[model samples]
Target chain A: MIGRPTAIALIAVGVVLTATAMVLPWYSTAYGGGVEVVVRAWGTEIVNKPGDWPAGELSPWYGVPVAVTAALLVAGIWVARAAVAGAAGQAGAVGVTAALVVSERGHAVEQQGDFAVGFGLVFLVAGTLVALAGAVAVQREAG
Target chain B: MKKVLSVVLLVLAAGAAAGATLLPFSELLISLAPGQPQTAYVTTGWSTRFGGTKDEHGPLFGIPIVVAAAAVLVGVRWRKVAFAGAAALAGVAGMLFVHLLNVISFHEAGNIAIDPGLEAGFGNGIWVLIGAVVLAFGAVVVHPDD
Candidate 1:
């Protein structure tokens, strides 16, 4: 059996990773100039304009989502640790499914046209299968 | 205490997952129908960045959220719950990561427009987070052997 603190720690790591990914430095090409790299803040946008990479400022409102997600992750882990394994597993499954669905949509947007069609289908089908498998696995384990 | 907390978590998690899955549809239906002419809500910068007709990313993450919830509910032991929670966190992290990437892509694409519907995106994230927190609380309350 895993310890509560360890479970919480795992969740904390995930939250940090998610936040870092948002603020990490990303590189992209300029329209005419060489490639440019910049640090992406939590609530900002990076744009390549007129052959130059520029940072577009986003409203502080953007941070609301990040904060909310962080809170949820923390709470979910804490609750899962205290609850029975079965319940915890179910909660985790639901959370994971929601996350996967959102991620797939992002993937579709990233790749459009034929790519969207192919990749979207893959995400839908594959993601559903995976979620189902996870749920079933949890059920079996809990039982 | 463990059993009671487990049930509570299960119920809350299920409710949260349902809400996350359905909220988008309600928003779309209320906004997109030509006859209705109601304001549409857009979440994420995907539409702004990619120049798409609609934002289609939220539903994609739904699958994983459901999976993670299920995993947690069915786990029989503490180790299982830990693993499941870890997986759930990973899914949440992945979603956030992709959104960040989208921010970069939008920046690179050179078209950053704030969607009037951006509130919807924030709402979705907030709700999901709430569900996650509730589930976590339940876990804590139901600590096995208590």
Candidate 2:
């Protein structure tokens, strides 16, 4: 069974990844005539170009992952059984990931150069999977 | 000491789960005949708006929970079989939690999917159920026989 320390460490790792991705989302894109502008709104990277923006917009929903991470921290520290909090955190992370997946797929129909889902999305998925690993660890330890 | 703590946690969990059963997991518009606005509450949780889900769905999830609660209350008295009772409760609660996950659906749509609002999505009943599963698991792990 995975130990408690290991589980906490995994959850921490997930938090760091998710927080970093959310706080410093710089998914960039190049517009006409060597202009590059990517603005961070909540957690989504918006390509600020006139009449030309990326189709894959995980906007508004982007903040959910970071919020979930913060909630996990609170759950682990105060007013909750760590195991229970971890399980809920995993579910929250997975829900965010699912939302992102659908958002990505719905816009994947048109391939354009201005569209890019870079390290931010990668980190989000990785962070969610890592948190899930932590929750599974708690489950196994109990078993 | 472990048995005491386990039973305490189990009682808390079971009580919460039982209480939540009477609460509305999702709300729906129930029409008696036509054009009459009537709202009905459903105990079994399911997503009502997002991902093409509805408030009305299967309502038979309360049976196993009742049996699990009874087992925890009565079966846990016997120290020799306390672990079995805890395990049973955990199993039943865990399965119900799993089944309730379908309240929200996910898929690729033509446009970016919007997040469901409080009234249209999961209610407090399902949240309590999820937490109860975790507590039930705690009871299972810390049982004296285990």
Candidate 3:
């Protein structure tokens, strides 16, 4: 198992990455009209246009739990009882993120187009993995 | 008391997720160029998904809802585990509200203006989600020591 400081540092880094992912665009597209970006954690533009305008989105809801839980895990890492909660929270956040990734992959495969998943997702999954590892570390030390 | 509270919170979370999915995600007075402004509601499934593009987020709500429901069945007998589930539910639901505030009101697609009014009404479903988060958190706080 890793040292306590390293574990804490990992959680902190995870929080930073997850928080960054939350703000970054989950999906985006550039076209002749202009560049349009949608952050499923928060923003999407609904312009009335007839038929396939060539853009897609995921719910901003996906970003919420992953971010919030990961952020909280940073603090929760300190105490034994809280560490368990932190571990659970980390697991939940990772689970949700993984589901989001899978769901996006599903859409890309089913639909016939270039449904690009955003770069933020890479940060998100990595952050969750790091955070989960940190949580596990903390749990190991506590136990 | 702990078990009952845990069940209540988990059930409430599930209830909120159900509402979030079934009810309109947002009520909007969408104004796009070339057409008269029309009031419309977008469901959690994100109505736009059916159109040119698709949304993966709307359907993803099922995961948490399922987790919450399963947690309810498990009871707080596993207090920490239950609390974690509750905490997760709260995080996700609360953030949906946060997302609402961060929503984009106006944008242009190629020269056409797509403006959902700045004051697009917050739908009932969103409020329920907020409520779910609170209840879920309450369960975490009320959870008894093992």
Candidate 4:
């Protein structure tokens, strides 16, 4: 079983990972003549030259990860107040993370580039850890 | 509390997985000869091409989900042993569904490699279904035997 503070810490770390995932490299490609394109979880940026003009566009799915992280953050805080409810939150987060990972793979595999592991991967691992902690914490509370 | 939550998750997950078939699983655009590119939607476990993947593969991903849901509900209502079976089945179903998505994403739309500039990507349906299944499985794993 996990202690309240420890579970909180796990949730906090998970939330951070989830938040960072949105900005980190989900996918990247370098075309001919120094043209580079990087796709984040939420946005896509194309850099024409190393120090020239870079234009970015927000993906429609950008809000999905942000919303997920926000929920995890709230769940982390809730763990301090109520372990059972927080466990449910953690479980929900785990589901979302898993979904993102599986779906992202389909998109990731199709792209041609030097692909870096996306933030979605980070969130999946973190969310799983947080969920385990929450599960343990809830058992402790119940017992 | 654990049982209730698990049941809810299971049902919702099953629902989402079933719903995914209705939405486009993947989008395949094939540019066979330049300006005459064709777009196709992989919908409801059936593949379609701009010109013609109308394979009558009956609900590629939905049957297992329905079975899992029935198993879960039955397990909760009467036999506790059913939960484990349902979980195992759901896990397998989830993997198969994800694999199907992968195949759809990379495979040629019309049995030939897609041309350059053609797009192939996952749709919202797969995401929702994956998430829901994970949630269901996670709930089962965390459920306490009271």
lDDT of 4 by residue, A5-28 (tens): 676666666556656665576555
lDDT of 3 by residue, A49-132 (tens): 335553333234655556556646667666644544544554545554455455555654555324556767677767767876
Q: Which ten contiguous residues of candidate 4 chain A have the minimum total lDDT?
A: A52-61
Off-target runs (Cα >4 Å) in candidate 3 are A1-13, A19-26, A32-71, A80-115, A140-143, B31-39, B45-60, B68-75, B104-119
TM-score of chain A, every prediction, order shown? 0.38, 0.61, 0.69, 0.55
List clashing residue pairs in candidate 2. Answer: B47-B103
Worst 10 residues of 3 chain A by lDDT: A28-37
For model 3, what is the C-alpha lDDT against the true structure? 0.56
| Residue-level error in angstroms, candidate 4, position A31 | 4.0
Off by over 4 Å in 1: A1-47, A50-56, A59-143, B25-38, B42-59, B76-121
lDDT of each: 0.41, 0.49, 0.56, 0.50
Candidate 1 C-alpha lDDT tens digits along A44-92:
3334433343434332223334344445554555454222232233233
In angstroms, give how far residue B108 of model 1 lies from its true place. 20
Residue B144 displacement (Å), model 4: 14
Candidate 4 residue B91 C-alpha distance from true site, Å: 17
Task: Name the candidate that leads on DockQ.
Answer: 3
Q: Write the per-residue lDDT of candidate 4 for residues B1-146, one digit (tens) a residue.
A: 87787667766765666676566656655566757756564544333334464633223444444455555545454333233334434443444444444445435442353365666667676677667657665666656654
Q: Candidate 4: what lDDT?
A: 0.50
TM-score of 4: 0.48
Q: Give the DockQ (C-alpha) for candidate 3.
A: 0.24
